[model samples]
Target: MDSPTNSQKTVSDDEEIDYSIKPELYDSDLDDKDEQWMAKKRDGRTSDAVLSCPACFTTVCYECQRHEQYVTQYRAVFVVNCEVDKDRVFQPNAIPSKVGKRTRDSEKQETGSADNERLNPVFCATCSTEIGVVDIEEIYHFFNVIPSEP
Candidate 1:
């Protein structure tokens, strides 16, 4: 049998696909972490290594931190160990959603220390997604930063 001649033009011969509307779809600068994050996102999942808001993909904390655990069901209970960590993880406008006063007794019962402090729920400033709760010690307890199993 005789072979057929090639008719189709290759991508290199044609104009590049217009990804201007969604440039991120064709972003060539995506690093390994970003690629992993994108893959996880496509699979309807998330990663603890990159603490970003699942709704808006706003990074709350980056990797390479020595914090206790960025990924956990305890709502990042020990993630922000101190003010420095808090400053690193949360932005300045990342304030509490609401304030609720907790008695020292109840606080002690829950955290094993008696210190009167107001507990507040932290929400994403961009999407207003309920990220987590700030406990008496100013530690974040994320409820659904990413829809991941812990």
Candidate 2:
């Protein structure tokens, strides 16, 4: 019997493309000390601190230098209150819904994801500077700001 020609050979149905490369592991050691420090500074302020530029819908935390300077030089600081309320200081159109949704989903999939609350950084209305952020579960409270010395 003669061997099969190139065009006469039978092809197997179980052949599959191989894609067995192992995924690369991510290193989580990037320096986040600055962010941690900033968050800590913002969380250390008292609630009685006078809110500046209250009409502007943005949060102001004590961790920001501009807020600190305003408090130091003028004895009072002004910040845009970005909390969601009747006045709505933050622009609804400016919020990125898709990004926020994706982040929320990712957090849900990770371990130790019990904390469902989210916080977004607030921006100054006039200069567009980041003054602080609002914690969703914290009763619309602002965290982090440069406070004037008492």
lDDT of 2 by residue, 1-150 (tens): 999998998877556433474436633543476557645655765333434433443334342332353433222232433333323343224534564444565655763343443545464555455445444443333333444321
Q: Which candidate wins on lDDT?
A: 1
Candidate 2 residue spans exceeding 4 A from truth? 1-47, 51-115, 138-144
TM-scores for every candidate against the unseen true structure? 0.38, 0.26
Model 2 residue 135 CA deviation (Å) reads 2.0
Show where candidate 1 strays beyond 4 Å. Answer: 1-48, 63-118, 147-150
Alpha-carbon RMSD of each model? 13.1, 21.5
lDDT of each: 0.51, 0.43
